[model samples]
Target: MKVLNKGLKFAPTKKIDKFGVFVDLQKFKRSLCLKKYFLKDPVTRQVLGENDGWRHTELKKKSHFYPKHLISKEITTFETMVLDEMEKIQPMRSQNLTKEEKEALKELAEDTTITIKPADKGGGIVILNREDYDEESLRILNDRDVYQRIPYNPTEEIKKKFDKYIQKGENNEFLNEKETDYLTVKYPKIPVFYHLPKVHKNLNKPPGRPIVSGIDSISSKVAEYLDHLLQPIVRKIPSYLKDTGDIIRSLNTITWEENFLLVTCDVRSLYTNIPHNRGCEAIKTMLLEDGEIKKEQIDYIVEGIALIL
Candidate 1:
């Protein structure tokens, strides 16, 4: 009983088309008729009126429909039966896959000449020659200005420094015992480096957009805490726009003058090019100007930012 979005269409794979068990149309139609009858019956209406179900608390919510208890129970029972039947058919469906399609899929998975990845900006998959993908990724990674070859992994070194910082903060009463414990990283790994090709920029020779994922790095907890502290202040900034939607809303309010000029700017590799010292100083300035953040908290935040940078 898979419900697809309106206007959305998809062709089933050969294996799926042959083996998939869809809902019985007659049963589905009968269920719909039952639901319609249930809604229109006078007895059901009287029950709803007596219970004041129209003004029920759940009605105000937008996420899910809250049907009348009797209707809901009946629907649940019907669905359960359908699901049970589906489970019985599942084993049979797996055994009935077309051998040709199955073999093709297996061969495709094992192929070494090509790589498949989601497009950097668009909402579709992109297939590229495996050699080309590797070459492009390495070319970007080898850029001396953006990345450098390290002699050894710095995971333990970074973890030690992070733990020492937390211990020092706790000793100085800047952070409570619980806060220090929360910030401590039991297991930290070095950030993983990857890149997604910007296919929209150039399909034949797409530039790789470098990504350094630090989710499991030593500074992850500290970074998360710092972001939590800074979010409120960030939202209050006059020029802060959360996303394209925010920019659109802001643009709608502007009373354009004849002399006013609309200008746009794009910084190439903005994140990698940012000077650590200048970035930290900017953050410090913002933290200092913010009246809500205490001086001690600001100092801790600045130190954390410096460590992360």
Candidate 2:
């Protein structure tokens, strides 16, 4: 089975359109037939009850049965409630726009496609110069020189390393249509859509920290797998503190005095603002210095981390 689709873009909206929507029905059926199956197989029912998360609820209750009609109606009702809440919470675009302001927007949008903007009093129709915006953005980036987004083209070395571990039928267990149907019916996959992220400042009064968002261009499962491999290496680092518990242990012996200077410094946008290439180099250096982790493992892990950057 082909595991990784090379040309696959991590766009949930496009993927959903290309494939189809997800709907769960098997879980409902299982719930409905709980009593029927339990009566037939006592041992199997007992095992299931032990494994299942529910503590007090009897697995053989006919009254607890879930039917398609009832479940579907409940789901629909919940969805309606959600929609109503959303409508109540989020004000519609152009909701409070005056007649004159709307007319002005209409006149401005006559020549080109325009999205509905906020109904603020200060002119709803402000035309943007794309070229100017791009130039200014580039200038700001160049001036800061904080970090650069690297192109993630998987090199041959990296690909070979990944291919070595990811063999046929090892981790790449392709689900059959029947299995897929059952799984999808139990836990449906929801398509996640990307939206324009708001660029904002952290509330540090002296010097506000500029923060930007990154597009999640990689599959979450792939990222999680990489994270698991990297965990051991991260744990090996002695200087770095992992959690609050570690910090507490480290500071346990310290005694406060009249002349003692205590300080807490927060890193502003540490992850995203760090230089990607430099970070990869640092990881490689750390691994090489460790002398315990094999060179092959270090190279593979470094390459995987670099690929994500």
Candidate 3:
């Protein structure tokens, strides 16, 4: 209300588009939304449930989020966010090594390299060779610039490799689609498919990675409905501007004659199995009854659905 009151005072004539507000998230699913916000906006005063600091540290310093709040006060804008993330990563990123770490890496990489497992995880576990460094192996190791090892017989190494192989499958591939579901891209795994190519595809492309030209995203059915809603936005844009969509508004008009809030919303746990309207209502409730949530101590995950209308 404070923010809304301030917004209205600033622009009395500005219409409020609060129709699509709120969020419905399962507890496990909150991380997904938080991951998105941390990557995109990375500024939240209200949320502090799941803190996946490792994931943030793992993310390469790229233009994923726009830094704000204190981080932004010190370093404003998204470009700053990208750079700061990158700079912080340089020291601790590769391996838990100091100046001595690189030298150890060099010494280890040269060996024929028997494998070992201090613990089973597929990355950066290398055993220094007793023989002259294998330049071939060294190249791969040096390229990554990180390795750790503890001597184990073939039994352990073989087990480690097999487990890692399976883990890699768990991390990237296999039948599970939600593995990389964090990235809103080529395969949404929503049973719908995009006709375009992948993104971060070429950092050099025009301005950089092309923005995924689509809705914030929803289920396959919701997506199909959205596509139908967007038909008018697509056809009404000036043809000349169509080629350069950067200048044209994709969804220029609304079907419901509803003025949408300038506010951007995020919902969680919205899978193909979920109903579209249910998801929408959840978002609405979340925004409308912000303080009441505190009063009632409602579960924040489903807080978005707490609305009168």
Candidate 4:
């Protein structure tokens, strides 16, 4: 099936529209009302019991139900509460901002000459000249070795190929009918490429950490399925550490020598540097060596990975 329209192109929003903010506010208010209902009785000012029929009934209705006593004043109270909370916290802070600071932030948001993006590593924002941002992004994208300049959109072509592959898989019994349907892309989107400035690395001319948003992309479901299949094999790797916490846990199990020196290394452009054929072969080798996956399943997994790559 055709997923995305031929003319569909991604355009990033520069500012939050009023309607979007209003919708968010309404959702927040509904959440607050639901929290109040579940945590405490709005009318009786007491905690609700687990088996409360009234609460369960209201929940089953799936409506934002409020007590009769709060029906009149609840909205006004929620608005006031939201305003007060917003006053106390900025987007990245729990502390209150001064009037001048708030005004400055409002001005910053409205400014079109600059772009604000979060740092790649730090929990901080980087404000860059829009021209510089575009120039840097272009520099990265123009690298002939990494990125190829496409003359035209290939979304439809890719979608057709993917659909054909899935159909073939179902016909050959590599995938069941249900699996074929589940893997089919309903609303595929071209992945949006953006980058976060690595401020910690260099403040003056921060290098950008490339990011490709894969939400609703043609291979998103296949990627997710492959990830699920590979996760067990990944976890079994000896050097695998899930996160910083995992590293710490692993470190604690070691008996440290006084003379030992710890060394750490970072791979430069790891993802972009890896040749697609080699990467796929590496995965295929790992799965084969593991002996847990069948040959047909391994082929399926590799094919999915190739589609994603």
Candidate 5:
């Protein structure tokens, strides 16, 4: 399912290949196929997917698929773990602590800075930061529990320089809490590349949880398509795709050993971003070095796709 734009980067879309294959990294029903292959291929030992699924295992007989990974969901649970740790601290911390432990706690406290945060039970959501905590803010924070951690307070020199970024007459603004201000919900959907065996991932342990799957070398058309579906209000989906792909490419992951096996994965939604003219162009010039689309052939490919688009 690997594909290439083939033409120069600056070339117009109408000059690329139409049927150039697209790999859907998160495709369903490919897990079993991959598992079967892994069991047979001595060089491999695992297939990846976003999560463990029965349907995936059911399809193992598909001859053309390879193992993909299934990712963990540990990231979604960090806040809960952090909160649990926070509560236990008050009792034990006030009780007896070894001299070394007390010294460590003292160092932690001295280095700690206050950060007011958003919470469900609090009054209207807001965030604040001060050089030190205030009694009013502390009482309110104590009453309403907010997510916080000891962050290094900037040195006076850094603070002075940072002042320029704020308006001269403006009240305290430009809080990084604004940047931190985000709501995250675990996606009901699974990312591709979720589960890989030790040898495949080259890791000694099942890299702990709350992680996600990732696909590589996807088409820009897919990015454009997903941009409208996923959120962040508006996201740089294309850039994210390229950046993510660049990272994976840099790692130089090898997923294939031969060509007889056809990996079947369809983009979640292939209807969008298929520019009629561009589709034709893509169907034309995209290819690998072993198989190339000549300049003259570009027109024919685009022309062929014109009807389908």
Candidate 6:
């Protein structure tokens, strides 16, 4: 069975209002005749009272439902599974391998390596590779055949916009302490670091994804404000094929021609590498073209989105 939030409306409660929690419809579920509603923690085998279910803990927030204690237990279980699977698949030591076995392994191995270490706080593993991966990654980033890289500066632009907003006393509530610090103390400086890409080993061959992380200069409040401003307008645009189901459906509708060429393209570091100025400009252009939003509002949005980039 598939549960989807495809058509759900955003209605946040007063308690937790920053990034609005998803609206859980227990009232609607009460209308259904077949079920007796209750909250149960499967891991702990604990059943809660009627008033203690969704009301006490926001149902949409998974962390609220499954707290640190439960998450730690689950992480340990998953870690054990990973270690067990690795042992089962790769029982023989690399030194014990015969010449032919080593040759076979070489044929199966990809041009990548990963080392796993236990995380300091959580019972999780930190997986990363040596500097050898950097050369290959850089090549991919610069390769025109793979991706046309576009660059933009957000640090200066964001600070300028924030300063303007502060001077004007507009959207002052949206600017949090961190964003203020970034604008004032950390002017024209944005720190960026790539998260380690996950690697799923297929016997010996392993392929890794390119690493990317979002802008971390501003506060979550500022990000949420921008999201709220842009989301409704952005939602009007036609969406691309999102998943396997969409792809299959699209394929079914296609008329396969005999002589036509089929070309596939994957944008490298798509989100992170998008030209920041171009994106903000595009959003402003679209909103202006729509003519529904006022010029002042569009200006505010564009200014807010500079930080978002």
Question: How much lDDT does each candidate structure score?
Answer: 0.68, 0.44, 0.32, 0.72, 0.32, 0.47
lDDT of 2 at 71: 44
Cα-based RMSD of the predictions, in order? Answer: 12.5, 14.5, 28.8, 12.8, 27.5, 16.9
- Per-residue alpha-carbon lDDT of model 4 for 117-228, expressed as tens digits? 8778746667888887888899889889888999999989989878887786666565554456677887799899999888777888887888889887888766765676
lDDT: which candidate is best?
4
Better of 2 and 6 by TM-score: 6
TM-scores, in order shown? 0.68, 0.36, 0.15, 0.68, 0.14, 0.38
- Ordered by lDDT, highest first, the candidates read 4, 1, 6, 2, 3, 5
Write model 5 residue lDDT over 150-233, tens digit each, in one string: 366433433233233222212222112211121111122323321112122222221111113322111222222223222332
For 113-201, candidate 6 gives per-residue lDDT tens digits of: 64433332223344445453465466556757545655876556656665676444234333333333333434333544233333233
lDDT of 6 at 273: 74
Candidate 2 wrongly placed segments (more than 4 Å): 1-216, 219-221, 243-253, 257-259, 266-278, 288-293
lDDT by residue (tens digit), candidate 2, 1-309: 001222433212211221121123344344645645555655543432144221111211124444344345565665556556544553334445667866864686673442222112222222333343344345445544564644664344443443443332122332222222222222223323211112122111112123344222222223444565456667877777888898998889778689988788978558877788899889889878876455665665566576555
Clashes of 5: 33
Clashing pairs in 6: none
Q: Give the Å error, residue 118, model 3.
A: 2.2
- Cα-lDDT of candidate 6: 0.47
* Candidate 6 weakest lDDT stretch, 10 residues: 53-62
Give residue 11's lDDT in candidate 6 (0 to 100): 31
lDDT of 1 by residue, 223-252 (tens): 876776688789989989999999999999
Off by over 4 Å in 4: 1-98
